[model samples]
Every structure is written in structure tokens, then in C-alpha cells.
Target: MTAEREAEFDFTHPFYQTGLAIGVPREDSAGILRSLGALLSWQFLSLVAGLGLLLLAVGSLLWLVERRRNAEQFGGSPAQGIGASFWWAAVTMTTVGYGDKAPVTLAGRLIALVWMFAGLIMVASFTAAITSALTVSNLQRQINGPRDLPGLRVATVADTASAQYLTEQRIEQARYPDLPTAMRAVADGAADAVVYDQPLLQYRNRELGERRLDILRNTFAEQLYAFALPAGSELRGPLAQEVLRVTESAEWQSLMDAYLGHR
Candidate 1:
């Protein structure tokens, strides 16, 4: 129970320990421009450009080694040789094995052999790096935890503890009438993310069949779920006893596991 409620009523010992969690859409194709911007990130572009430069350097080296003797495949002129070498580097690195170009001289063959092995490693590394970059860009919305709430377009249910917490913390939010509406604000791109009770967000996330929403594990603003009784109510003592008794039992753990799928 919040301090505000505690002053008016007696509450049993907390039965459940939960916290506010952040929820975000896994993907919202709502903004084509935003997706494109992420795809063309500086890190991604730099990797591509760097690979291109590597190809050029390898192609130039091959031309220097093969231009005099194996001119048939290397090319006739300096310009032609460089262009042919470029094609060779690309095909070789990709393992296409077009058979249109083959190094003849010992030096050229040695260089090609070295490139073949290096290309395998480079290709695998670049592929993994690009995939990771895209995945991070797509899934991460700069809201990893509570500290990221500042200046974010956060959504939450109005008149709830989550809302009160945001207000007291001075974090700006777009309050909705309920949890679904607040979560929908995030899915439709109206808000960057949603903040709400952990169990509520988790349940809603699973119910969203499309699996578009994900509840972050970064729980904050811990809350206690308790039974509030009228002042001086006799049931308060018995209820508190029951809560503590039940919560301490193995059956409680089993119940939680059956419903929440055991942490």
C-alpha cells in the first residue's frame, strides 16, 4: 500500500512483492522512415564502407602481381587490370567461384590463397556484427530501465500507483484511463514505452497474441499488494495472519509457478 492509503486504513502485511515495469513494443512498423534511419546507422554504414575498401586493396594487389604475365585474366591496361581485380576480389570473397578469373604467378596464387581464408573469417564476422547491430536497433528503444524515463514519452494508467510514482518522480507521462489503453499507446507508436505494475504488464504482454509487446525485467518502484481494512477492524488481525501463513507455504510457490511460469 502507498503511504497515502496507509493513513486512512489499516492494511495487512504485504502478500505480494511486485514492482513497476517498463513495456515496449517489439516492433512497430508504424514509421518506415524510422526503420530506414536505423538500417542506415553510422556503425552499419562504416562496416560496409570498410569492407568495400578491403576489396579494393586486395584487387589492386592482385593486379600488381598478375598484370605482366597473366594479363589474360588480370586485364590489358592499368584501368582494366584494376577493374578485373575488383571483380575477382568480390567473387572470391563471396565464394562464388565464377572461374572467369584465376591467378597464375606464384605471388598472385599465394595472395589469392591467403585472401580465401581471410575472406571466410571476415564474412562471418561482418555478418554477425551487422545482425547484432540491427537486432539491438530494432528491439532497444533507449528505455532499458527506470533511469531512462526522463524526457521519454511514457504512458501509464491514470490514478494508479505507477502514475503517482511518475508524478512524484517528476517524469513526464501520457496517462491513459487503463492499462490496455496505455499499452496500446506504446504499440501504436503514440508513446515510446509504458510503465505499470509488473504482473499486469506481464499478463497483457502474453495476451497480445502477436507478441508485439515485451516487459522489461528492470522492475522498479516496488509495491506491496495487501488487503486494506477499515480502521480498528477486527478482521485485519486475522487477515494479516492468514496472508503471512499462506505466503509462507510451499503451496504459494506452486501456485505462482503454475500461473506465472516459474522464474
Candidate 2:
């Protein structure tokens, strides 16, 4: 779940305005860059694919060894035995052994021992890959609310509510003419993150795919959208009532679904 902090923007506060910022250490920058580079490298992808193929090959080998020798545990027709072998390989590789099946043969046990060690290496690589993917660059994982915006390169569209909010909070930001450009800044590494409307950010993130960008679940300084009217307009009350009525109807839901999907 997304964690939210208070929306109060204290412009006069030293923490919000200016101070000696405690940023990610420069010493760790090289390691973080290396990790990110590895994650996006072709070599890493090849290694992952090779490991997957190795798992399948080991599973097939196990099936060949146990199918005839131990028919009861790894029993059934050739196809079924192969399927069981795959199940066993998967469980063993993940270290989730159920112990319902085992190989009694010497050769099979030797293969299992080798596979166990290989699985350890594979698992360690997978964990490192996931960690590198998650902790990309210096933005560790503390970005939960607007208060965390200090010392980060933030982007937003110019002349929008988000831009105004950033200004009021005395937060440094890069302003773009449009949402796409602002989001692209984040993706291109020109900006560390983008702050904009939740729906627009969500739609853009979906379009860009999670690997390219992601939207933070928590939102701060929420504002209500309203229609503007001429001063002393008599139609205000009726219009407001009708707006509420229509928004509560199925038609509004259908419109939302058509535009933004169920998400």
C-alpha cells in the first residue's frame, strides 16, 4: 500500500527551502550505476535465458533416469513422467521440495546434488537482478510523499497545479510544456521523477510500461476539480446537482472505463 504524509506545504521551513542536503553518497554511485547497467545489459539477459534452458535440460535428464528405474515414484507414461520431472525440477530449483517424490538411483542422486548447487547460484543471481532492478540509481525507496521531494530531480508540466504546488513548496523542479515531455525527462534520466495528476501519470505509466516508468501509489496535496462559471450565475446550483447526479450514474463509470480502463 502507498503511504501518505500530510499535504501541508511549509514554504518557510528550512528543510523545505534550503539546507545542507543529505543525498545519496557519491561513493556508492559507481556501484549503483554498475548494477543498473548490468540489469539493462544483453549479457544479463543471455545469462537468464541460459539458466532457464539449463533447468529444462536438467528436468528432462531427471525424467530419463527415473522413468524406467523407479516407476512408482516417477511413474506413468513417458509424457506424464516428463511432466513430473519438470515439477520436481521446478520445486527443487526454488528450494520448495515437497518430498513426495525422490530418486533412489545413485546417478539420479548425484545429478540432484549438482542441481542443488546450481540452483543456489541461479537463485542468488535472480535475487541480485531483482534488487538491481528495484533500487535503480540513487533514489533508494523512500519516495512516498511530496515531503520526500527535496534533493531529487523532479519534473512537472508548466502552468499546472503540480507546477504551482512545487513553486509554493520551494522545491526545485524542471518544467516541461507537456505531460509527455515531463514523463520522458524521467525516463531519459534527465529527471529522477515526475509529479503530476494521478490519472494522467497512471495512464502514461501504463502506456510506457512498468520497465520504463512507474507511478507512485500515494498522492499528496489532493485537489478537487470543478467547473468555472460567470460571477453571480443562477445556473450554478442546478449545474452542480446535475453534475453530481451524472457522476453517480452508470454512464460516468462507462466513460471512465472507456478512457482509463478498470485500473
Candidate 3:
């Protein structure tokens, strides 16, 4: 082949190639991206769904406890009824800006404002709690980290992305229902390493002080942590996109760095 023809066919060149060398068509690329998008969407929706349920539960409880006070303050308005109180609490918790049915009277408005701010704090606290809980639950599924070493029978949390990665790599994997069991397996010499999310790894690394375990330098995949739900849910895609946007925002980045460090 002429130098020009060689250059034209040089898909492996450091800078120039725009298409896959293995002849994966653009359609295939799109399909792969779509599948990944779906997975992310599932996760995001799961988080939102969990939070939404929590908000409903909390809002109901709060409204019930505060309804009598609110009714008296609202001049015996039925707006202080359980349903209305719950609605107010929901709107306040999520910070959803629906202009309908806000407190019109001075005392009612002041109470509403207080409730609004309270809702904000509660929602934030609830979200953090849920995330922490889920992270802990998710981490329990994976063994520690790094499976490539000999005699290391690493395990991942069942149904997690890490497990999926192992299956893709043809790596033999053990699945566990929870972290304590997985850790016990390691302590018993049943597994050599554990492959799990960074949060889980960090938490365990702290908990396993004085242990002789080695966390590997080699990271297998950069799986995005997300809420999971059944496929094709309506809230999935929008929630995923919102989460991605938030994650990419400067505030999100700072929060991540504060928690996970600058890396």
C-alpha cells in the first residue's frame, strides 16, 4: 500500500482515527451507549423513588402532628387538614416550586415559610441518609478488591456492576448477599481479595485496621453509582440526566472532593 493509503487505513494512529478498528458500526456504538444510559437511568430513578417514598412517609407524619396547630393558625381553614398538610409538606420537602395554595394570611405564611425551610433541611438529611444506607448495602455485596492475583478468589456483591464486570472478563466470581458474610469469607481464607465500590472499600479499609489485606492499585472499572429500578420507568432518564448534570456541576465536584478527596 502507498504511504497515503497506509495513513488512511491507520486507525491505530495516536490522534487521527475516528471510528472503531474492529468495525463496530456507529449503530453498535449508539446501542452500547443507550444500554449504559438505561442502566444509569435505572439507578437514578431508584434513588428518586426511595427519596420520594421517604418524603411521603415523613410528610404524612409531620402533617399529622402539626395539623391542629396549623388549622387554628389558618383560622380554621381545611387547608390544615391531613391531605393539605401532607401536600404542603411534600412541596416543601422537595422544594418543588408550585405557586398554587401557599399560605395567604400573615401567620399562615410565616408558618408556611418555617415549614418550607424545615422541609428543605429534612429533605437534605433524608437524601444523605438514604445514600449512605444504599452505599453500605451495595458495598456489602462485594468482596474487598483486586482479583487478578493468584490464589485470590475475589468476590463482588451480587447483581452489582462489579459482578457484571467480572462476568464480562470471564473472571471466576463468588457472590455474597452482604458485606459481613463476605468479610467473614475473607477472614476465613475463602477469598483472597474483594472487588467492590470505592466507598465500600474505603469504609472497610478503615474498619479492618491492622489487617494484612492489600488493596490493589489496579482499578477494573469506573462504574457510576446510581439508584436502580425496573427497566423502562418514566422517571429513569430524566433523573439520570439530572444527576449527571449535578455531578458535573462545580458544587457536586466540590462535595465529591470533600468526601472522596481530590483524586
How close is every model to the real structure, measured as TM-score?
0.57, 0.46, 0.32
How many steric overlaps are in each model, in order? 0, 0, 8
lDDT of 1 by residue, 1-263 (tens): 98888999999989899999998766455345455666688988898899999999999999999999998988688889999999999989888879999999999999999999998988898879877876665555757898878877899998888999999999999999988888888887788889999888877666566745768887898888999999889999899999999999989987766665522
Q: Candidate 3: lDDT of 126?
A: 63
lDDT of 3 by residue, 152-250 (tens): 366667976667666776777788997556655654546645666655554454455444234443455653345443444566666667766776677
lDDT of 3 at 14: 23
Positional deviation of 14 in candidate 3, in angstroms?
28
CA lDDT scores, all candidates in order: 0.85, 0.67, 0.52
The residue-level lDDT of candidate 2 at 188 comes to: 66
Off by over 4 Å in 1: 27-34, 37-140, 261-263
**What would the per-residue lDDT of candidate 2 be over residues 54-95, giving only the tens digit for each residue?**
777887898888878888877898778877887888789889
